[model samples]
Target: MENKYQFETERLGFRQWKEEDKIPFAKMNANTKVMKYFPNILSREQSDEFDS
Candidate 1:
């Protein structure tokens, strides 16, 4: 597959969301520790809707 990136630094990279990333990103959003700054954990459905 071809690489898709929005931008990159010497040691970091960034990109916009792709269809394949929704599920994994939702999983990350569902992690309480990862969402610690937020008031509550998000359900997978809610997380899935985050970018919608």
Candidate 2:
């Protein structure tokens, strides 16, 4: 994969989103704690749809 920009911190690397990040991104969106400010937790289907 190629990114136009890349940067490294003491313990982390930052880059643009990749296709492989979809699952983890979906999991984050589906997490109840992460969605506490919203109306409700997202279903897997909803998360998948949103990630698209």
Candidate 3:
């Protein structure tokens, strides 16, 4: 398989977001428990626009 990750460790990997990551990222942004400190849960479009 190709190594698409920017870097990896025994237990972790880091890479820029891919097109496939949007759905999961949006779901995470919409999680109340996970976003307790945020002003509000993000919509899918907002999550899609997230930078950094």
Best prediction by lDDT: 3
Q: Is candidate 2 or candidate 3 better by TM-score?
A: 3
Q: TM-scores across all candidates?
A: 0.65, 0.52, 0.73
Worst 10 residues of 2 by lDDT: 43-52
With candidate 2 superimposed using the best TM-score fit, by how many Å does residue 14's alpha carbon deviate from the native?
Answer: 0.4
Clashing pairs in 1: none
Worst 10 residues of 3 by lDDT: 43-52
lDDT of 2 at 6: 90
Error of 2 at 13 (Å): 0.6
The digit string of per-residue lDDT tens for model 1 on 1-52 reads 8668778899988988788998888888889889999998888788778677
Which pairs clash in the backbone of model 2?
none
- The residue-by-residue lDDT of candidate 2 on 1-52, one tens digit each, is 7655598789988876777777787788788889889998777678767545
Candidate 3 collision pairs: none
Superposing all C-alpha atoms, what RMSD in Å does each candidate have to the true structure? 2.6, 3.8, 2.2
Segments of candidate 3 deviating more than 4 angstroms: 1-3
**Comparing 1 and 2 on TM-score, the stronger one:** 1
